[model samples]
Target: MAARIEIEGDRCIGAAQCVLSADKLFDQDEDGFVVVLNGEPDGEDLEDARTAAMICPSQSITVVED
Candidate 1:
């Protein structure tokens, strides 16, 4: 399955947990909020991306199967 990661800017609180959990997939913006560096991460990185999304405190990260 192909996975896509999306971040809800409105819900993000600059916790940086997503980036901390999965740096390859997530990056911190000037405001410290998370941004999806590579929306589509592959192989083992994909699992980490999903884990980051699932662990987000703000529930701002979303992972979709395509």
Candidate 2:
């Protein structure tokens, strides 16, 4: 099963850190909030995505295995 990342919109503080950490899997909206570019990141990009979730200041990111 592939691992997936989920964002809690309410918990997000509009921090773009996730996007900065993993551009391939994350992007910021015009408001500077992060949104998942791809829920299923593969290869090295997946590692970056996981790191981004772990380092998120607001703890808004959730990683799940399916």
By TM-score, the best candidate is 1
Off by over 4 Å in 1: none
What TM-score would each prediction reach against the true structure? 0.92, 0.87
lDDT of 1 by residue, 1-66 (tens): 888888789999988888888888888888887878899888988989888988899999998888
| Per-residue alpha-carbon lDDT of candidate 2 for residues 1-66, written as tens digits (9 for 90 to 100) | 588888898888977889888888888888788788899877787789789989999998887866
Give lDDT per model, in order. Answer: 0.87, 0.84
- In candidate 1, clashing pairs total 0
Candidate 2 positional error at 55, Å:
0.7
